[model samples]
Target chain A: MRLSPRTWTLIILAVLIALAPVTFPSAFYFRIGALIFVNGLAVIGLVILFGYAGQISLGHAGFAGIGAYSAALMPMHLGLHPALALFAGAVLSGGLAFLIGRPILRLKGHYLAVATLGFGILVFIVLNNEAQLTGGPDGMAVEDLGLRAVSDALGLGLRTAEVWYWFMGLVLLLGAFLALNLHTSPTGRSLRSLHNSEVAARTLGVDVVRYKLTAFVISAVYASLAGSLQALLNGFVTPDVAGFLHSIEWVTMAVLGGAATVLGAVFGATILTALPQALTVFQEYEHLLLGLIIMLVMIFLPAGLLPSLGKTLRQGESI
Target chain B: MRLKSTLAVSALAMMAANPAAAEIRLGAVLSVTGPASFLGDPELKTLEMLVEEVNAQGGINGEEVVLIHYDDGGDANRARTFATRLVEDDEVAAVIGGSTTGVTMAVAPVFEANEIPFISLAGAVVIINPLNPWVFKTPHTDRMACESIFTDLTARGLSSIGMISGQGGFGTSMREQCIDVAGEYGIEIVADETYGPRDSDMTPQLTSIAATDGVEAVVNAGFGQGPAIVTRNFAQLGIDLPLYQSHGVASDAFIELAGDAAEGVRLPGTALLVADLLAEDDPQHAVVTAYRAAYEDRFEEPVSTFGGYAHDAFWIMAQAIESAGSTDGAAVRDAIEATTGWVGVTGEFNMSPDDHMGLDLSAFRMLEIVDGGWSIID
Candidate 1:
């Protein structure tokens, strides 16, 4: 029996995901793995925005901040469950994206980038300044998601981080599958068209404005989900989650791993997530190396690592 | 297929052979990278040096101190993640870290929830207030520094002062405390101004303060780029009025970064920096000299207040663990809480549950720059 490409991808992902845990030296590695998945989830959203739709956001961390703060504040203040707060964060992020995207998306290139930057800075300033409500710069506590309790009740033993790692990995897989499906859908086609040439897409009745807004809102939801997962996993939140540097780091991860491909984004996230641990010896040189990698990758592999490698492989096969 | 299967089997065999090892792991979630990188970088080095020192001295009660260090990149969320990992996975004996108040605050609750002992290098008073029994601080808080500064200003007969601070957690906290403490000294704040963290030129703020009527002295609070810039601005404007810097400028980096402008700048800080100026008979002199020599020999850099605090934090923890006779978090917390007359590189630490800040105003001395080095002012 032959497997279709989608089925083959799923099977491969499942095998890798299941087998990865076996190599852990300690449960510490599980927490790191969970961290990678949470960050990967955010990068996947960037792939939808930058890779598929050709939209740039320098402030996606703002949505992530909203998601994290929601997960933290709503559960404590409103007495809502953490899972419900995660949904509330996503909805809030979506609504924010909708309201801000309408005017901001109309601008092109650097103007749009600056406007989005402003929006992110605005959110960050609010979170940082509203000390009494948000616990100020000192940050606040987040409620646990109770996944460990559920596993305990079911007689399935798992560490706190192990559960979060597996859960987040499953969520990432689902997010990737949905994003891949969207890449081949009619709406995805319109987004790609608009990405290539907005004027031409408009002429072809692609409804460029609506498609762009849709992509922004969808990506915001993804970022919000990633943020909520991070808050849940760490059981804490702070305004720095929505800071400018974090926003840049997420974009860098997506662009570095070949934003055009789901697998590439995941690969990028994983590499970055693990690089700091591996480069512990080069303590001072870490930042220099990171800056150099970003520069070299942009210069040499403009389409990113995975996409460029795929192109080379295809050409070699043809030869 | 056979090769792949063989490889998989070998990988599984390797994993199974390596069992999880139990050690008294301690986590240091620090700002190893970012604008606050200087603080975290030295901290990491100091921590490494301390670990080596402890292990060389036969470890903590026969159990090796395994440090699980994480770079917060000066982000609070990353700090929290590292703290959680330390508590939930590494099962750290105590989590020590957070170069800045923001990161420390972010990670404190995780320590509180898990009942893991935490000690912060950040000097924010709120860090230990409404105190979680699990949390304690080594560096003197801003409130103490503010009180000391106000006392010094009163002695100097400077009753009217101008204020300038950077707009950040440390800066805002220090500024607020200074304002509150100034009233007790009958000191009036004639002018007040603030600059953002990224602001390079504080000339506008300084110039504005200089213009204020009857301002006898200027109190500048903030660290890193902000203090350096403020110092240069004060000098350039030819403001002969005495300029008082917060203890945040108690590093050689400030003198080097601020150039000639740092000369004559009065500041308040722990006794460590000016140990050489202390009488040879003073009890703290010997410890200070030894710490300075050891640190300089190790890192090839002059000892700053950061290194002093980091050294104190590690030594104090070691002492607590020794007193507890175990690595239990509760035992260590109890030992630390009951600390008294614990002489360290910084000052003699005396902690109680009511005051997690071990050192009070008496632990600090007024310092002024003379000939490009810190000198005892009073």
Candidate 2:
């Protein structure tokens, strides 16, 4: 039986997750693997906004900052569980995205980008300036998720990061599945239609404004969740998570890996995430290489690595 | 498409199965791939050289040091993640890193909780405060650097100073210290202006400083972009009063990046840059000469005070490890805390439970750039 594109994507993701551990030379790989998943989760949200919905957010890291700080601060101040803090962060990010998206997303093109950038800067400024609560520029400590302790009690012989890696991988898979479903659903079609032409979608009675807002909120939630996971996994939080540079880095990862494809974003996250580790010897050339990669990829593979590669494969089959 | 998918899957599987196993693993979380890359890049160079030197010297007592470094890209949370991975997964002997105070402070608790020795390169007192046993620092804290700068200014009879600093932690800390210490030294700060990190031009701030009454010198408590702005604006605005920069701006890059305006910029820094000026018979001459030779040969660039700090941090850790005769965190911590009279490229580093900052004012020398090189002011 031939699998649909969605099914194939799911199967590929599952196989990749299942096979990742086979190559783990040490438990350190699990930590790195988990990092990739966490970052990939954020990029997956970008796939929904930038790829599926054709919207841009220069400050998605702002949501990530909210998620991270919420996870760090909520438990300490409100006496909530860390997990509940993660949920609260998501809700907060979603609500903020909803409220801000109405006015900011109303602007189009460069204006929208700049507006979002300002929003992100505002978030960063707040997090940094309100150091009394967020630990200022010095950042703050996060409570442990106690996953290792839970595993210890359950007699599971896994390390703390190994557990986090597997758990994050599961989260990524779930995130990817949800994103894929959104891509195939009617709302997804509406979002895509709006991406193609907002005016046309509006004329077609698609409620372009509402759909765009939905996409923004959904992506914000995804980014928030990713940030919460990062805080939980790392056991610390800082305002830099929401900094403008971080937002740019996330966007770079999305576009570099093929924003349109969930797997591609994950691939981009993994490659970019591992590049620094692999290129430790060429530390000086890191920026030159990163700039070159971004320029080269955007110039050569405009559709991104996966989409361009996918096209080539289709062409080969047709031939 | 199927073949590509299969290859990717197999590759990931291969990565997952091969986990690192090494003794005496050292993790570094640095700004290796960001705008702050200038500092992190050289620091990484110094670290790699130190690792090579240590390995060549029979590998940290025959156990072989394995470095697991991550590019935090100057992000604090990412640094924290790397620190966590270093502690929880790599089970590293120690961590040495953080180009920015934000990152260093973010990663400090991880080291504290894991009881891992963490030596921060960033000059933030918050990273080592309240007596975290596992935390040690090589860089002179902002407080020390501020006091040193004020001391130099007072000695030079520059009683009235204008201040400009970025809004970041390093800048704010330096500014606060300058305010506190300037009063102690009977120096009056005439005007204080602050700019955000991304501010490309400080002309407005400099213009304000220039207008301040009786300002004899301008003290810039910032690094990287901020210093570049201050120096350029000082020249452009033609505010010819003497300019004193924080040691954070004491780099060859700062001079080059700041153009002709960097001339006569006074700052408190280690003897690393002006090492060539020291007589060959001087105690610090050999250490500086060797570091300069190795660093320039390897990275094709002049060494900064950062490299000095990096070199000293690793050497201090090595000395502590050797003294402890093992990689035990508590043992290394105790050894480090007990460190006294240990002379290094930066200074004679002395540490105690009450004072984690290894050096005081004596560690720094006031330097003035003349003819495109550093000259120590007697």
Candidate 3:
């Protein structure tokens, strides 16, 4: 029986999430696996913002920075649990996106990009300057999410890495599931139509501004949640989390893996996240090789790896 | 497809052929690229050179010393990822590096949890404070640098002081330490101002310091171009007060950036910077001179204090391995803690339970920039 592509995507992701650990030589791979899922979650948000809505956000890492700092500060200052801080950060990020997107999303193309970039730099400066509150650039430790204690209470012994791997895997699945459902929804169709041409979509009775704002708010929440999870996993967060380079990394991850598809974003995140650890074998020449790969990929596959590879495979099947 | 499969096969083979028990693996993660490369590049060269030297001389404790290294690109997440790979997959006996304080702090927990010795090259007290058993650092902590300057100021009877620091982590750390350590030395910080790290002109902050009452000396704490800009601005503004700098600016790059304005500026730094000027009887003189000669001969660049930290880290790890008589992590951790009276390019080392930073104020020497070069004073 032939299945729909979305269903196949979900099935493949679930099976890979469960069975890939069988190849691990040690528990260390679990940490890398968890890192991939955390990064994939963020890139999935990029898939919505950049892939679906066709908007550019060079400063999305700013929302991540807010989420990370919230995870570190809320529990210490407001006497809330780290788990609760995660939701609080997501909510706050969504609210900030709603407020900022109203004005910034009105501008098109590079102007909008610059406005978002300015916002990101502002957040980075605040985090760097507020020495007393945010611990400045030296970074501050975060309270644990207390998952281990709860697992012990339930009589399920698990390593920290294993627990995080499972937790992030579940979160990424939920994120991907939501993103896939949105791919066929009315809002998603409006977003895609506007992405094709704003004037045409507006003529067709689509609410251009509202759809764009919705995409921005939803993507901000995803990025924020990913940042919160990362801070909790590392037990530390720095101003770099919100830096412009990290924002670029998320975008690059989306574009590198075929941003239009959820599976592609996951593939992009996995490769980008794990490639460094794998490249350690190259030592000094790692950067050189990484640059070569990026250059070669962009030059050869303009449509990105996943989409282009899928086209090739389909062509081969026809042949 | 052939090339990809071949690469995978070789990788699998490499993993299958793990190091024998007779081999000891030492891992280093440094920002060999990106913004912090100025610090990490010298460190990477020093470690690469020293690893070859040790391996040439029959390795540490007669076991082949295999160096596993990765470039973190000065990113904290990359540093954390590399640290995990080093401790877990590589099975390194000890890990060294993370060239900046932020990167070091990010990976300290991984090394701590895995029970591996992590000798950081960065200068942050938080890495070892609250006492993580597995982590230690080679550079003098930011708190130590603050106390060193304050001690010199108090000795000179300059009790009233002012400070202008950058907004970076290093600057923030020193600012807090200066304020906290001032009361201990009976000194008063009359003025405190800060500038952004990218600010080319610190004239406003320096002007504020100059206008403060009873300010006997102005100290600038920062790395990169920020401190040099402060010095140039101080000279340009013709501030008459003595200008002090932290050890963060102990390099020829600072002098070049500040031009003649850097003359007569005093700071506390390791003896390695002014090795040739040290007295023959000085305990650190011979070791410092040897290290300076070897590093300059190999890398063909004047030795930096950051490289000296790596030099000390290498010897410290080597000494711990030799003393422990094994490649085991816990054994090496205990051996490093019990380290005493071991001298290196930086200072005489003595590690203890409470004091992971073994060197005291004695490790630092009062240095003055005379005619665009370092001269040991007092």
Candidate 4:
């Protein structure tokens, strides 16, 4: 029996996640692996918004900031569990996205990008100014999720890094699975059709605005959840999570990895996240090398790493 | 193919491990590329220079020193990851730096978890307060800066103060610390104002502060060009009140940015900034002069106080390692905790169970910008 591409993607992701630990020279690799998964989850969400729906957002990191702060603050303020706080942050981000996307998603191209970018800056300003509440720029510490204790009680016998690695890997897999499933759904088809030509999609009875807004809200939730996971993993969150740079990073990861493909987006996340850790040996020249690599890839592969490679391979096979 | 890939992985691991077992490895994570590079670049250079100096002098206790450093790009997440890598992967005896308060705070728990000595180059009270046994910092805290400035203000009989701080992490921290410590020094903050870190002009905040009743002096607590811009604005607005700045702006860059407007602006800074002004027999004079000369000789730039933090961290770690007599992380942590009366480029460090900074208020000197250079004030 031939497996669908979606099934293949899932299988591949699962296998990679399971097999990654075998090559771990030290427990530190687990931390890097978890970071990759966390970043991959955010990029997968961007695939839905930027790739499938063809919407531009330069302020997605604001949602991430909200998610991170929610995880940090909710436990202390509302007496909610850290897990529940993560969920609440996602819901809050979705609500905020829906409200903003209604008007902002109407814009096209760079106008939409600017609007989203302004939203991110506003969030950053608020987080920075509210020193008393959010601890301002010196990010406040977060309470532990008590997962280690629970694991200990259940005799799971896992290290802290190991727990984070498995948890984030599972989260990324679930995110990818949903994103892949969405690619074949009716809403997904409408989004793709609208992306190709908004006027044409509208003429064919597709609700363009609704689909765009839906994608935006869904992507925000994804970013929020990723932010929550990151804060939980690091045990702290700062205003940088909501800064314009972080938003650009997420979008860059999505585009660089083939935004349209779930696996490609994950690949992009892994590379971008892991590249810095790998470049530590370069010391001062790490930024130079990183910039050079990005430039080279963009120059050679205009459609991004995975898409360009896939097309070239397919063409070669056919020839 | 699997066997081949495994072979490659093992080969790479072996290559990473070939730095010789007798070499005492030290690690550092700093924001060497991004906005905080002004602070981190000098720090990285200082640590590298120190290592070379030590190795040149027959190494530390007959073991060559290896410094493994990573650039965190001023991101907290990157700092955390690099801190973990330094602890778990490189297995260094001690870790240093996170050039900004936010990055240092983010990585503090990692060092605490690994039980490795982490000596921060940043100046934030939170990095050491509520003391984590594993973590220590070189630079004076935001509270100390506030205390020093307030002490000066009180001494001048300028009890009523107006404050203008940037909205960055360091700015906000100093603002709060200033407010919190004002009562202890019998000072009253008559007006408190803040401008965004990126704001080119802080005239509005200064104007408002000047307009407030009983505002005797204005204190600006922020790093980078923010405080410099504030100084320019304060001069432009012609607020003749004694202008005080935080140690966060202890660099030549601030003087250049503020131009003639920096004249008469006072700040409490490390002795490294005005090494030549110190008495001939001063404890820190020798270390500061030697470090300044060596750094200028190598980098062809004026010494920054940020590098002095890294210098202190290096000497403290070296002293700890010498006292501990081993490369063990736990031993180094204990030795660092028990550190006392060790003179460094910044000040004489004296660590205890409660106080991790190991430097007193006297570490900071009152400095004024005369002409275009830093001058020590009595």
Clashing residue pairs, backbone N/CA/C < 3 A, model 1: A131-A136
DockQ of 2: 0.35
Q: Rank the candidates by lDDT, best first.
A: 4, 3, 2, 1
| Candidate 4 C-alpha lDDT tens digits along B1-378 | 222332333233222443458889999999888878988999999999999999999888788899998888888988898888888878887888889888988998988887888899887787887788888999888898899998888788889999888888788888989999999999998898988878997878888999999999999988788998999988989888899998988877889889999999999998888888899988888999999999999999888888888998998899889888997888888889898998998888889878899888899899989989988877
Using all chains and alpha carbons, the TM-scores for the candidates as numbered come to 0.83, 0.80, 0.95, 0.94
Candidate 2 residue-wise lDDT, B212-295, digit = tens: 789999889986678887888889888879998988777778888888888888888787877878887767888888998999
Ranking by DockQ: 4, 3, 2, 1
**TM-score: model 2 vs. ground truth:** 0.80
Q: Per-residue lDDT tens digits of candidate 2, residues A206-271?
A: 998899999999999999999898888877677778889889988998998898889888878877
Question: What TM-score number comes out for model 3?
Answer: 0.95
In model 4, the runs with Cα more than 4 Å from the true position are A315-319, B1-20, B200-204, B229-240, B256-263, B370-374
On the 0 to 100 scale, the lDDT of residue A139 in model 4 is 80
Deviation of model 1 at A271, angstroms = 3.5
lDDT of each: 0.82, 0.83, 0.86, 0.87
Query: What are the runs in model 1 whose C-alpha is more than 4 Å off?
Result: A1-26, A70-85, A99-138, A143-159, A196-200, A278-319, B1-27, B54-68, B84-95, B109-116, B154-161, B180-191, B198-217, B228-242, B252-265, B369-377
Q: Candidate 1 or 3, higher lDDT? A: 3
* lDDT of candidate 1 over B292-370, digit per residue (tens): 8888898898777776778888877888888998878889999888889887776788899887867867777898898
Residue B172, model 4: Cα distance from true site in angstroms: 1.6
